[model samples]
Target chain A: QQPVQSPQAVILREGEDAVINCSSSKALYSVHWYRQKHGEAPVFLMILLKGGEQKGHEKISASFNEKKQQSSLYLTASQLSYSGTYFCGTLGGSNYKLTFGKGTLLTVNP
Target chain B: DAGITQSPRHKVTETGTPVTLRCHQTENHRYMYWYRQDPGHGLRLIHYSYGVKDTDKGEVSDGYSVSRSKTEDFLLTLESATSSQTSVYFCAITGDRGNTEAFFGQGTRLTVV
Candidate 1:
């Protein structure tokens, strides 16, 4: 099943902070975060594994709670470039398939 | 950026017609996925392929079919297109077993009239 993301949309002023949360009902092996700009492809941000290990782009960071089957993306000192739709993808037990959440639209105004 | 290319970046087809979108990757990633992005639905997986000739249906597989004849090519076909099927299609690839990040193609905007 697809994961659920909270706050369908949010508006932020430059340098403000925002957090996007993703929750999954089933156990997850890994959680991935990606950002998509308008009319562009989704770009990888970071990934959190079951063991609390995180690997991803240096500019973005996230946290994964294996016990709770949840993940949160932290955006600090947001900039206009941070404006976009953020999606969280989850990977279950064995397959390479990744399912994504509905997405959170974040608009950063200058 | 990952050597992934999607053909016919934009297409407009009539209802009940057959349309095919092609995804070609030079990365030779073992896993290839087809997803459709709608306004509120986000990106919904339509189908996926693990290897050549090894494909499986995803959550929203109805009215769609897929084929992977070679390691570098994966194709998604709409047997009979409909207005409801109009959306942006993305083709993504991952080299490892869910450990590495997926590389996505630019995407194909398909419109059914």
Candidate 2:
């Protein structure tokens, strides 16, 4: 099943912060995050393992909660380059197939 | 970039026609995936292959079939296209399942009329 993402859309100033949450009904073994710009491919961000560890990419970071099957992406001091659609993908059970959330549109203005 | 390429970046086909999208990778990854991107649906998995001749259905596998005859290529086919299948298709590759980052192709925009 596809994961659910909160705050379908968010607008932020260049120096603001934002959070995008993803919740899955099934137990997740790992969570993957990607950012896609307009008319471009989705770029890999960071992957959180099953240990509930936190991972970071530059100023962006994410935390995974194994017990709740949820993950959140945090963007601090958002930059104009951070403006794009963010998708959270979940891998459950032993299946390698990744299921992604509908996505959260993040717009960072100057 | 992970050396992934998707053919026919833009395509328009009539309803009930068959269409095939090709994904070629030079990274020699062990896993390949097909996904469709819709306005509000985000990116939904259609099918994936673990290795040559080893394929499996995904969340939205209906009306779609996949074949991997070689390690470098994975093909997604729509046996009979429909208007509902019109969406941007992407092909991704990963070195490991859920253990590594996935690299996506440029994407193919398919329009069914």
Candidate 3:
């Protein structure tokens, strides 16, 4: 099943912080975070394993909760470069394909 | 970043015509995938191949077929193009499942008229 993303869209000023949440209905093995700028392909951010470990890249971080079948991405001290659509790819229930959430549109203004 | 390249970066076709998109990777990754990105749906996997001649259907594989005859190439074909299939198609690769990060190609903008 496709994962669910909260706060379909969010606007933040530079230096502000924002959080994007993703949830799945099935037992998840991992959660992958990716950022896609307009007119470009999605770029890998970080991946959270099943043990609920937290991972970070620069000011971006994410946590995966296998038991709860959910994950959350936190972007702190946002910058204009952070403006993009964030997607969470999920692997769950012994599924071969990684499913993605609808995505959260983030706009960071100067 | 994985040296993955997709062919026919942009295309336009009439409805009911056949369309094929090619994905070539120089990384020799163990996995390759075809995904379609549409507004509000993010990217949905259409098909994936684990090894040469070994393929699997994804969440949204209807009307699409895939083949991986060579390790460096994976192809996605639409038997009959439809307007709903018009979207930016991306090819992704990963050395391992869930253990490694996946890299995507520039993408192919496909339009069905």
Give model 3's docking category. Answer: high
User: What is candidate 1's CAPRI-style docking category based on DockQ?
Assistant: high
Candidate 3 C-alpha lDDT tens digits along A10-89: 99999999999999888888889999999999899998988756454766888777788888999999999999999999
Lowest lDDT block of 10, candidate 1 chain B = B94-103
Go through the candidates in order and give each one's C-alpha lDDT: 0.93, 0.93, 0.90
* Model 3: how far residue B44 lies from native, Å: 1.2
lDDT of 2 by residue, A1-110 (tens): 89999989999999999999999999998999999999999998999999756454867888898999999999998999999999999988777788899999999999
Name the candidate that leads on DockQ. 2
Each prediction's DockQ against the real complex: 0.81, 0.89, 0.80
List, residue by residue over A1-110, the lDDT tens digit for candidate 1.
78999889999999999999999998899999999999999999998988878898776678899889999999999989999999999988867678899999999998
In angstroms, how far off is A102's CA in candidate 3?
1.0
How big an interface RMSD has model 1?
0.8
> Which window of ten consecutive residues has the lowest lDDT sum in model 2 chain B?
B94-103
Model 1, global lDDT: 0.93
What's the TM for model 1? 0.97
> Judged by TM-score, which candidate is best?
1
Cα deviation at A67, candidate 2, in Å, is: 0.5
